[model samples]
Target chain A: MIRHHLSDALLMGYSAGQLPEAFNLVVASHISMCDECRARLASFDAVGGALLDASVDDLGESDAAVPESSLAATMARIRAAGPVERTRPQVAPRRGLLPAPLSRYVGGDLDAIRWKPVGGGVRQAILPTDKAASARLLFIPAGAAVPDHGHRGTELTLVLQGAFSDASERFGPGDLEIATAADEHSPVAEQGMDCICLAATDAPLKFNTLLPRMLQPFLRI
Target chain B: MVRSESVTRADKPGEASVSKLVGKDEMNGTAEWVAEMLLVASNSDEAAFAHLFGHFGPRVKAFLIKSGTEPAVAEECMQEVMATVWQKAHMFDPARASVATWIFTIARNRRIDILRRSRRPEPEDLPWGPEPEADPADAVSLQQESRILGEALKDLPDKQRELIEKAYFGDMTHGEIARVTGLPLGTIKSRIRLALEKLRQSMT
Candidate 1:
């Protein structure tokens, strides 16, 4: 069972289709693992639904008129689209180390990931997303620790494999740690197994150590 | 419970009371649309599809345009959205989502695709088939809750309501939403939990 879940702001932004691509991916991945967040996200969607159901007069907009032939055109489009398949009982595909949404970006499961060493025993692969934010998969060897760092904007880290313990708490699989600007610490991979995480940041991180800070420009961490 | 959270200091108190009086009509309207959607799902009924299109098409277009899509593009996307509704009508589950809520999800997805040029990752589907048949009692209760939620939205103070609308219409970024509005979400959250409990039972 997942302990930490997404914030309301993230959920609502996702429901409204307004979050950055990287943030959306993280939210989607987390929701895949957490039923509580899934239900909460649906609630946020219902808000969007409520807004859509509003009458033209209620919104005080007299100008949102569709053309007379629009319905006929949609009907024509429907005919061209062909019939839908009969509804089938869909069991969710078995979840691997990566959730379904993350798998789409990686193209497969954990073995499919292409990892590059950032430094020390940590490896990272930056996923392609818009300029607004960055998402990456992180691999930290057992008993290793990332350099101390502070965030410029917000950092969302979701544990996908093994466990990691930071100053705050131990984050096992499906637990999300949302670190804001005020937080600064090094997260160490717990003993026994390598820790792999999906982490997204809206802004660049500030490494506390001078060496790591210098490497930041080249590493894009 | 949904009402009390939003009943604070309505700018137009008279208008708030007026909407309360019409709440019954809104609930009836939702039920009628749900029935119409079922007809389309079961029989591929053109008449029912057309009726749904008549009510929702303009609203969807307006929604897209408000989100800053060009009017022509919005109209085109609106057509695609309606087509998807027809093609995927068999997936409609009134026990889980009202017809308007279902359509809103489609419109939101289309808006993201046409404007953002980015993939919107969706959560994995809950392991379940479409309702073999919608539960009438569950459907009505869900509809009633949604109507009350809508009224609560209208009764919100203008500033609060506008902030919520701005978040939905793409005027506010996710970061901005964190700063701009502590939304009146107590009621909405409870309603969702209620719906989720019902859904969980049906799954079993």
Candidate 2:
């Protein structure tokens, strides 16, 4: 059973278009693999519909742009643009645990990733995305542990393959762990298999130990 | 949430004009009429398309502007969105969503596209939000769900609702909301989370 899940705040953030770019990627990938979250998000969208339908106060026509030419201009544009092709809803599901949303980031599947060694047995490949936030694909060999570190800002870590145990709890595929400024943990990959995770962080990691702290600046984690 | 009767009443602003020729007897069918207008517009029916443009255009513009879009850009986006509505009308299913929900989503997506294009200097960029999925479900069920959600939202405390409105309608981040409201980040998250929990409990 998929126990660990996205916090209500994250899902709501995703639904409302309020999340920053990097965190949104984690949410999208997790939702694709978790049906429960998908259903929950659908409910949120329904609420959005309800809000739009009832909201008459904000949509005051008096303040809206009413130049009649806009209608004509829009009509001309639509006429000029010609027809839009209908989109197919769902393709056959890809073989990988990384959903289409995440797969595109790495170019293809698990084998397609070009992992860069950060430290110890933990390796990561930073995905090119918004400069305000950063995302990366992490690979940890079995029995390897990430250094115990706190967060200066929020970091969302989603496991795409294998399982890992942190101070909080064990997380598997589709499980999301939200580590904020108050939280600190060293996550260890379960011995049965290699662990691969998609992580997004807005700030540098705050290492708890002297060795990791000294190495942190060069590690750029 | 939507009372069945309020839903019929919800279309008053749109049907009030169409009712001039179609008569008041057809007013209850207003939601279906909007969906049909999309279908008709797909077939290049200029009158039907123009009517849709007139009704949804201004509202979409206002919605975009509330999200920090400039009026000029919002106006441009509004036109672009309506044009997409016409071109992709076949995708609009009255059964799976109400007209308001459908149009709101279209407007939201269009605004996001515009925002992304303006910000991202990269040639190959991925979207930040969940891509719209094509779910085909019963029309009345989705409407009832939306109405229930609306009702659930009404029951929430004003303080909680204010946060939600900022997050959803105004496009404020949790941190941004904290800065503006002078509340701590933890407090803002807790309030919104609690209110959402109540909404989830009541709706499901």
Winner by TM-score: 1
Instruction: Write model 2 residue lDDT over B1-204, tens digit each, in one string.
Output: 222432343344432122233234443333444434544534455656666666667767777777778888888888888877777665554434556666776776676677772121111112211223222223334444445556677777788767767776776654554443321123222333343343335333
- TM-score of predicted model 1? 0.88
B95-121: candidate 1 lDDT, tens digit per residue: 567677899999999987877645678
Clashing pairs in 1: none
Each candidate: RMSD to true structure?
7.6, 8.1
Model 2, A48-146: lDDT tens digits are 555655454555666566578988988789769876565434444367766887887788888889988877988988887776678889998988998
Model 1 interface DockQ: 0.44
lDDT of 1 by residue, A19-46 (tens): 8788899999998888778767877787
**C-alpha lDDT of residue A133 in model 1:** 89
User: Residue B17 of candidate 1: its Cα lDDT?
Assistant: 28
CAPRI accuracy category, model 1: acceptable
Which of the numbered candidates is closest to the native, going by highest lDDT? 1
Candidate with maximal DockQ: 1
Q: Model 2: what TM-score? A: 0.77
